[model samples]
Target: MSVPVAPTPGSAPGAPPGAAAPGGGAPGAPPGARPPLLSRGRWDGVTTALRSPAVLALAPLTLIIAVFFLVPIFGMTTIAFAVQTDDGGTRIGLDNFLDLSSHSRAMRNSVLISVVGSLIAAVAGSITAFCIAQIKSERLDSVVAVFSSVLANDGGAPLAFSFIVTLGNTGIIFGLLGLEAIGFTLYSWQGLVAMYQYFLIPTMIMVTLPTFVGLRKEWTEANTSLGGSRLTFWRRVGIPIATPALLGGWILLFGSAFATYASAAVLIGSGGFPLIPLSIDSLLGSGLGAGGQSTAMALGVTMVVIAVVVLFFFNRLQRRSARWLQ
Candidate 1:
């Protein structure tokens, strides 16, 4: 017998030679060989394309922030430094800031009003929130909700006008009480604080309500089971948990009060209680060129600074409370 010819390992026996492998590649790839379908760079590109949905989704929000928030802030900051010339040219400097700071009475009044108003709102809000949460009556809760909704949206010139009618010299309350002859004036700082509280209380309640709702029923039950008094329970469990909401609400209230102008303008009747906003308005209306605009901007900047500082502390307090709650 002739020596058996060794069949080619990859070829069909007694059939055509040099037939391609089914996969069009060698049976076993080399240790470091890349797949023919997708190299590393191409794979990376595919992955990047797949991730583009996130980018697309974020684009609209990014555009909105850039256009509305960031642009306005940048423009205002720029104007704060610019000095306006007779020919409408601008020279950038710190003169505007100096002028704003020099208006000490306005700055002082603004600070005081904001602080007092915020504090009052915070206290009232916290109390209202606590009471609403603890109360079992649905009708009362509904009333509170409706009341808050009305007050929170009440702002600007219309709100000022409303307050003027409600709390002004000829206000319904004073008229009903027949106290006009007794010289009841809602145009004072005290009246402003009270008017601010009308809205502030509702805002505070809304802000703090969630915090109250978040309180564990078990905590209250356990406290009561342990014979802890209501006051003790509040001190030990309630305040700590709600501190963040309370502080945050207060900061928000302060910021709102700081920026308020229409209400102050309407109630105080101009020049009598020149808060920072009023001062800014006067400067802008004075036709004092870029200097006035810059000064007004600087005052705005100061208000922003105050708000930021309050917000920072409030945030810190919130974090601490969260940690304690956890």
Candidate 2:
């Protein structure tokens, strides 16, 4: 059933295999004629992409993370169980865990600081989101949103320096206010809590802003029409619906504060009270100034475990809350 046309000019009979194709399009085509690729359908491109080696493009990034992130975690865990001999050789065992009293104190203080800061930030951020959502002017809301976005990720060494400039022992603001009569220490626990809120609130705002948009005003009106007080309605309905996003935001803030090193390291210094991160940096970097490296490694493993556990709960909260928010 094959009807034969004359062989193409460049694809003559008995030609070499790759010399040209029968259509004279791919390997060779008539002058001024369309190329084979232009004649192909859209599905061909999709199929080509699917079959391409480009799918493994992220392999390098994945390999880098495995080497840098997971390797260090595993190394830290291994070192926690290792001991140094008098002759300078290292042996591995459970000796580090045996004396975890000071480590426990540092872990507890770090958790306390992170939790308190995150909660304060989440509450403040939620209220700000609500206020922003209720704004009459879109321009104002946009400006505030842009400002919050900038502040959210600005908690680096510069932020710590700014705080120091504004509130340190010999701070400019303190001098202007003439508050030398009342004593204040910027390196104290309270100062850390306040400094944490500066960044954490913005983090919370970004995280929970979507939830504000998800909130339906009709639900509030309906609750009011049903004779429920605003407080009662918010406590029973609004808070329940928003719990997932709130908790998720709080967890984000907590993780950021917990892993903070530069700010604490810069402002508070190693001489400050042993927050877990500070302790780790001091023990390992300062060669156990008043602590051991194995202990620091053990604290690091403890943080990894805590992060995993908290994220597990945050994910569950998200799934539950997404039922309404989505």
Candidate 3:
């Protein structure tokens, strides 16, 4: 059923590939034609990507992070390295990092407080989550979630002021109840940890609640049906499943407590307790103390590094926990 077909004028018989046709165009093309500058498919792909829902949704957040977080971090890192000169100038140097030796006590205090507070919050929060799981009321669960959310976000000046009113000198507990007889004070190291607990425990609860609540009742029931005791069920299944979340929550709490400055600033107010955050504040805020602004920035940079490390481990543990939870 073959029919005689006429060849295009430009595509003549025995024509060489890519040879110019009669009207100054490539073979098989019309006269005076040009190739496309960009591939239509590639352009369409780019257009589709621009119109993607995920990209559009993330645009604002990406801009905000770039402007606020990344930009400031870059500026801070630059300032951290830019050592002040005696001639009232700046030079790129490690003077600030070297000056960190003077603040060893602050470093030690920061590590101690963050570690102890996070550990305590982890244990206490786990217990609280378990207790909360025992409650079957949906309303109570919602209430706890809301309460934990609110308290987890609670800190800074208001929290400090509340603590001051409740525990500071001339306040209710110490002033009226005479609890000061036991040598209790809100401005001490122990009190700082207590203040950290005010929020960290709730943060832990927020992190652990889902895991605890979502624990499959059937697993425990099967264990019990298999002649296992309640304690044995928990000892084998509960602890193993919950441990990752607990560790991740602990690391998160550690970072939170480590970076905390507002509440501590208001409550301690340049007190004897030399925390890393407080030290940075003092060094930078006090007209550049012996360590100077660069030193404060260095401390800030150190915190950023520690936070990054903590977040890395936390994410890994969260992934591990997610597997078990799922």
Candidate 4:
């Protein structure tokens, strides 16, 4: 019916104004109208590309882990379960594990040593870290960090030898201060724990230093502004934020001490020490006994399982701690 409409501005030469485009909504379509297929396809392609960077970045690490870690673990697990025959043949069975049960004392000793040493390291390290954080000198912090890293990595034969010459019976401390007179011997489980502290405490300090440093002055000021005492601030705010990191560091220290071999072996020979690592060594070289490579592999497998669980909890705790740090 029949009013003539003026040609819409910028309309196609021969097309009516307000008409739909060839493949989509009208050029002047409402905001909610679907985009053209080409545009949509472009966005889909962009979304796909966005998902690829993380995968690509992680590819090398994943390949290395599969080849080194997973492959070794698979071989070890198979060996752990394989029984050796009198005729020098191997067959899949649980004989190694069954034999390992007899070494429960070694397991218990290892757990006790690791747990106690790590706990001591955790407390000592946390205190040290807290003190270090309070100091405003970046130079001092860097020095301490460098020393800690060096000491943490310093283990094995040289460390064992140093401990012996310095703390052993008739060693330097004994000669100078007569520490032996005090009935202290660097050859017992107590000595092992002491040796662990030389490394574990340094490790704990490194792990905890960052968390303590991240405790901003504003946070303390905020708590004080709320009429909280220093004690109250730590009780409510500081401890809560740092707890996850502390626990995670402690677990890491425990794992380190648990898996240690060379230092313990050198300081206290496998024949004397009943720790799992020492037991593994003894079993592996036993030659003509039930304690052989298979049993050693079984112990190794047990350690691997424990390490997996420890790492899982450590990662979870680290995630929680990271949230607060950020």
Q: Which stretches of candidate 1 lie over 4 Å from their true place?
A: 1-68, 82-93, 137-150, 178-183, 288-290, 319-326
- Across 7-106, the per-residue lDDT of candidate 1 in tens digits comes to 2222322221222122223335553444465444323333343345544455567677777877787788888877766797878787778776579988
Q: Give the per-residue lDDT of model 3 (tens digit) for 148-226.
A: 9999987788888988888887778678878688888888877788888999999999889888887789989999999
The TM-score of predicted model 3 comes to 0.77
Sequence-dependent TM-score of model 2: 0.72
lDDT of each: 0.72, 0.72, 0.80, 0.80
- Using lDDT as the yardstick, the better of models 1 and 4 is 4
Ranking by lDDT: 3, 4, 2, 1
Q: Provide TM-scores for the models.
A: 0.71, 0.72, 0.77, 0.75
**Which parts of model 4 have CA positions greater than 4 angstroms off?**
1-70, 83-93, 288-291
Candidate 1 TM-score to native: 0.71
Tens-digit lDDT string for candidate 4 (230-312) = 99989999999999999999999999899888899999896676999898888878875655877888999999888988889
> How well does candidate 2 score on lDDT at residue 291?
37
lDDT of 3 at 113: 89
Residue 137 lDDT in model 4?
A: 74
**Alpha-carbon deviation at 156 in model 4, angstroms:** 1.4
Better of 3 and 4 by TM-score: 3
For residue 259, give model 4's deviation from the true position in Å: 0.7
